[model samples]
Target: MSIIVQEQTGLFHLQSSGMSYIFQIVEGYPVHVYWGNRLKHREPMSDLLIHTPKKAGLDRLPQEYPQYGSGDFRNPAYQAELEDGTRITELKYAGYRIIKGKPSLTGFPAVYVEDEAEADTLELELVDAYSGLQVVLSYSIFSDRNAIVRSARLVNEGDKKLRLRRALSASVDFQGTRDFEITYLTGAWAREGNITRKPLHQGETRFDSKRGMSGHQFNPFAALVTPQTTEYQGDAYGFSLVYSGGFEASAEVDSFGSTRFNIGVNSFDFAWLLTPGESFQTPETVMVYSGQGLGELSRTYHRLYRTRLCRGKYRDQERPILVNNWEATYFNFNADKLVSIAEEGAKLGIELFVLDDGWFGKRDSDNSSLGDWVEDRRKLPGGLADVAGRINRLGLKFGLWVEPEMISPDSELYRKHPDWCLHVPGRRRSEARWQLVLDYTRQEVRDYIYDSLSAIFSSVPVSYVKWDMNRCLTEIGSAELPPERQSETAHRYVLGVYELLERITTAFPDILFESCCSGGGRFDPGMLYYMPQTWTSDNTDAVERLKIQYGTSLVYPASAIGAHVSAVPNHQVGRMTPLEFRGDVAMSGNFGYELDLTKFTEEEKEIVKRQVAAYKEIRGLVQKGDLYRLKSPFEGNESAWMFVSENKEEALVYHFQVMAVPHPPQRYLRLAGLHPELEYEVQSGDSEDKPIIGGDRLMHLGLPLAYEQKDYESGWFRIRAVNPGKA
Candidate 1:
């Protein structure tokens, strides 16, 4: 059993192979006991929870779910306002139940168990005797992964309506600990997921997103590691929120040197009203502990998320190498032009041809035709089905791009229903990218969009859909919601989007869905639940992607990142990189091309053909193998990483240099995730020498890189174990 209860001592311990999370009910208050490397069951576990002096009060003790107005000055996990306008409430431990499997968060995205025996869940019930507000904190310990999935459910048991002012998912108190540094991902627009680390201070340090979606500003992930922690050494704790909307992750050090960590939905401009018998379920937060180091912590997340969080047939399958026409023709391409590009793509071994925006209503550019899903006869004289047929005839699958969440003023849908967008009647309706956010909070609006999209999806032989949301929310007031319930609009809108996705993805299970928000803006686990991959960024520059993809790997699996090769004098940044370097960078993730293939020179076309063929040879290993980041792009001019197969039979190592230096020091790239005793053969494109070496020697001594004289140079090595069984 992964979870153990010491009823006589009022203690509950959730244990995994490498980690343990323990808590105790002390005089009706749940108190955090220990969370770190696993301890023996026979050890003196009760002594771990020391009782503080009465003079110190509740603030001094490590609380499991601290509440405000209870002497705890730190931020509370939840806050509620009563019918009598009072805010103070005390919750006592009521009871708990151990379940066989993890329960899904109603109307939310979470990590799930396919089989009942995969995990054990402990539901700790707490209740406020005065108001009948019941809070159930759920903790699920996975049998295989070193993670604890946590969430909260607030039930309004009383007859009176309970207004929840702030509801966060989970909070943990690191007792007697302050020697920690926080690491998080932060960036904007074209540059998303830049890794940043700083020491934890006395006050609160928070990273959040308030732009409606989990914006490009900061990812809903944070880690606490000692100053001595490195990639492969020391202790680390990771927290990730499984939500797509606004979120907050914070770490605060108290006066006594204890640190409190919390993560969940951002309570900004948010409130939930729970009527009698109604419940509000917060999104789940995944907690990972690694005594070995950050590398192990990240690998645990990668394995769990790749296998459990991401579902459907494509979860374990290789992603197709696609060519999206967005950067190729923009909105200016006609049917013949698109067919020519797809025809070229087919010659280059590209598997999918995606017709981007402007195939819809009067959408010449980003200015119009957002919500209107109908085909634009001007660009495609013969509807989408005809274009799809043309691409299908070229031995390639067909894909379409649609921004179903935005409404353009010039579109027929908006003109017919002006009130369909999220806006205050008297206030100015803010338009971004010349479009307004659709009022997804309204069922009728969602139904209409679903009907419009389903009609087209069913008509065409579409194999994939790039679901893009170009803009964030503004004037967020919903016309369908009352003034008192206006604050609920953002969360409700997220739920509404999830509802629509559930319908579409469930209906067309064969069609691959890739989520995009003007690029990587909405790249989050919540979105990953529905869409297997995300367009990593609009900036397809190889040099820039070195950092973007490197930082994204901190939390997201490489299979979920949609990286592509674009034209030189890159669209986002005017930095010209070698075609080979661009292809090498894009091949690290879900491989694809975003440029017009028909215009490539014969030499360039040949390079692309080789790139496509190389990707096909390694796609399976790259998509499902374990990733080992050898060097960080943010730390130097060079970047390197490796992907090792699960069975330790094959591996791919990628290295990139942004610029060359004269008389540079000789560097060796040490590899990881290989069988230490096995012998392997290493081969690279630039060299014919297939050196056979022991894996232990490769990891300890490493492979040497030959100095190159050019800028934007890159290389990849394919490694295969020799005689695996004999070894």
Candidate 2:
């Protein structure tokens, strides 16, 4: 069993091969004992808990799920108000049960186990006798991964109403803080997922998003690590909220230098009213402990999320090489123009052609016709069926883009039901990209979207759907929600989106869905639960993607990133890059193209053909292999990364140079994650010369990089073990 409980000592220990989380019930409160490298179970393990004099109180002791107004002066995991307006409540340990398998959070996305033996869950119950509020803290430890999934459930067992003001998912109190540093991802629009790191300080350092959607500004993730920690070594603790809506993750250092880390739904402008017998479940937060370092922590998350968190028919399948017409034509293409692009894509080995924006209503630009899902007769005289059929006949799958969550005032749907959008009774309704957010909190609104999208999916042979939301939420109000429940609008709106996604994805099991919120805005674990992959970013500039994709790979798997090659001067950054460099960058993820294939020259067309073929040959390895980042783009002008298969039989290495220098010093790039005893053969891009070397020498001595004269030069290498049995 992964979970072991010492009944006599009231201690519980959750263990994985690489880590352990231990806590004990003292007097009445559950005190955090230790969370770090794994330790053998013993009777004396209970001694690890520090016991202070009664007068010292919990302020000096570590707590598990600490509550406000209790003895603890630090931040609490949750806070609530009673019917009498009292906010103070003390909870005492009740009882706990060991469950065979992890239980799913009601109406929330979380990691799951296919078999009962894959994980063990411990449910620790605490009760506030004064208010009859029961809080159940669940901790599930995976048998094969160095991670723990934590969540809390608040049940109003009393006859009165309970208003929760702050409810966070998980919290941990680390004994010392001065030695720790915080690492998180932050950026804007086209530059999402820029890694930021800083030393831990006296006050709280927070990462949050209050823009309704998980804004592109800050991701819902944070990590506390030793200052000496590097990508390949040192202890690291990572926390990630499995939510796509507004969220908060923070690290607070008390005067005593103890750090309390918490992560969950943003408590800002948030509240939930729980009536008698009603329960509120917080979103799950994944906690990973890596004594081996950040790289192992990331690999654990990559393997777990790719195999367990993401679910669908396409979860384990090799994604199709697609060509989206957004950058190619934007809002200006007709049926003939689309069919021509699809023909060109098919000739160059692209498997799918996506028709993006402007095919519906009278949509010529981003200004109008968003709510109407019907095709415009002027753009496609024969509707979706005709174009899809043409593309299908040319041996390419057909894809369509839709922004189902937005409504343009000029559209017929919005005109018919102006009240359908989220708006206050008297406040002005804000418009972004000339569109308003639909009130998903209303069943009718969700039904309307589902029906509209269902009609298109049923009528056409759509192989994929690029579900996009172009703007962050504003004027957050819902007509269907009562005044007392208005504070719940944002969370309910996210739930409604999930409800609609569940219905559609479950209904059409064969169609592939790619979630996009202006690009990487909504790229989160919650969205990945329904859609296995996400459009990495709207920016197709290869040079800019070095930082974006590199930072993103810190947590997200390559299989879940939708990367595409685009035309030069790139539409987003207007920086011209070599076609080969663009292809190399895009091939590191789910490969695709977002350009007008018909406009390519004969030579460029041949290059694209070879790029497509090369991606096909390595797509399996690239998507499923373990990634080892050799060089970071943030550290220097050059970047290098590689992927090694699970069995260590095959590997692919990619290196990029942003700018060239004259007479640079000789440097050899050392590789990692290979069997030292095995002999391997390495082959550079399209080169006839093959070199055989031992895996030990490849990792220790490294490979020599060929110097190039121009900027934006990139290359890839393929490696295969020559003696598999010997290794």
Instruction: Please report, in order, the local distance difference test score of every candidate based on alpha carbons.
Output: 0.90, 0.92
Span of ten consecutive residues with least summed lDDT in model 2: 44-53
- Give lDDT tens digits, candidate 1, residues 370-433: 7888889988889999989988999999998898999999889888999999999899988888
Residue 255 miss distance in model 1 (angstroms): 0.4
Off by over 4 Å in 1: none
Clashes of each: 0, 0
lDDT of 2 by residue, 68-136 (tens): 886788888999999999998888899999999899877888999999899999999999999999999
TM-score of 1: 0.99
Cα-based lDDT at residue 260, candidate 2:
94
* Native-referenced Cα lDDT, model 2: 0.92
What TM-score against the true fold does each predicted structure earn? 0.99, 0.99
Name the runs in model 2 displaced over 4 angstroms: none
